[model samples]
Target: MVTPFQVHVHLRRHLMKELPETDDAVAQWCRDQFVVKDGLLDKHALEDTFSDKELQEIRRPVKSLLVVTSWAILVSLGALKFLHWSALLSSWKGIALSAIGLAVVTVLMQILIRFSQSERSTPAKVAPAKPKNGGEPSETRQNKEQ
Candidate 1:
């Protein structure tokens, strides 16, 4: 999961400007600038600011972390069920283990919730980039010039 701090760092590194001091402000800035539709960053909207390689770099870690965390929770739940079925949960050690598992799941859930909240915020529309010449878009003008 990508924390607001991580998003702030990425924005700072990519945009090279001072950002809002608070995490919520930084997150809001991201929502305003980028197209986040349905809890996902729109890569097409990011094309103007980030290269394909950079987009992939930003996406990979979050995807991998989510997958790993989800699998961990599932495995932990399965283990807890097995322990209970075998009557191991009757012991103090088993109770401790269950508590630890519950705590881990709780933390993971909180992370997921935060991420969802950040991504699911209302996204501002990105206006099309217009050419200063006022004849055509920059891309088309560039193509014609070439």
Candidate 2:
């Protein structure tokens, strides 16, 4: 059996060879696709499977949430149909109230984040110094006059 260290070395070379050439555009492309694998013996192991297709594959579940949530609501209401109206009122009341609370909290969070980001740096502090006029202060003037 191949040792893990040897396997890691093999993977690392494979990753480096597969990386785009060191031109700016290609490097940026690689940066988006490739992450530095720190744990392996050859730490910079880079493998394939980075692309728009990969991202879409990853995002499938998130994109399906709208469809899933709709179906969930339909199923729940179907089960609720045999129940009394009071059951419906009690079951969904908290969900509706929580949704409203979430909206209000989200708006407040956005306002707080915007204000925090917009805060400007305070003006730099100036060192205190004796005020000077057209002539140097007398204590210093005699030294200059000499």
Candidate 3:
């Protein structure tokens, strides 16, 4: 949901000039340690390396604006399509309500996006094995006993 402007501003503010190569040795180092090395290394063990402060700072307003603007555009256009502009002007309450409805919808969609991504990823595949005790021994164990 990050907009181009927010991304550009963040990079410029942080003085980030270029992206790191995926296979770079430094990338591996950062995986176990902090990529930024802003004295936050080794804080999170194997978990995502994102900082909540940075995340909230960046994500909050960026996400909000994206929602708000998209809402504004979509609602305005949809309203214009569904109802006459003159009619909307006559009923100020209806126009205001539609705007509110669009804002609520935008927020709801953002929440759902966050939750869906946070859901646990599917586990890796594993081969099936014989039951432990179904009145029969595993083939390997039976062979070893013989």
Question: Could you give the C-alpha RMSD of every candidate to the true structure, in order shown?
Answer: 18.3, 18.2, 13.5
In order of appearance, the predictions have TM-scores of 0.27, 0.23, 0.26
lDDT (CA) per prediction: 0.68, 0.60, 0.63
Across residues 31-70, which tens digit of lDDT does each residue of candidate 1 receive? 8656534223344345434333454343467788899999
Name the candidate, 1 or 2, with the larger TM-score value: 1
Candidate 3 has a TM-score of 0.26
Model 3 Cα lDDT, one tens digit per residue, 34-62: 44554444444344443454543434667
Model 1 residue runs over 4 Å out of place are: 1-81, 119-146
Candidate 1 lDDT (Cα, 0 to 1): 0.68
Candidate 3 achieves a global lDDT of 0.63
Candidate 2, which ten residues in sequence have the lowest lDDT sum? 49-58
Question: Comparing 2 and 3 by lDDT, which wins?
Answer: 3
Q: Identify the superior model by TM-score, candidate 2 or candidate 3.
A: 3
List the candidate numbers ranked by TM-score, top first: 1, 3, 2
Off by over 4 Å in 3: 1-78, 119-146
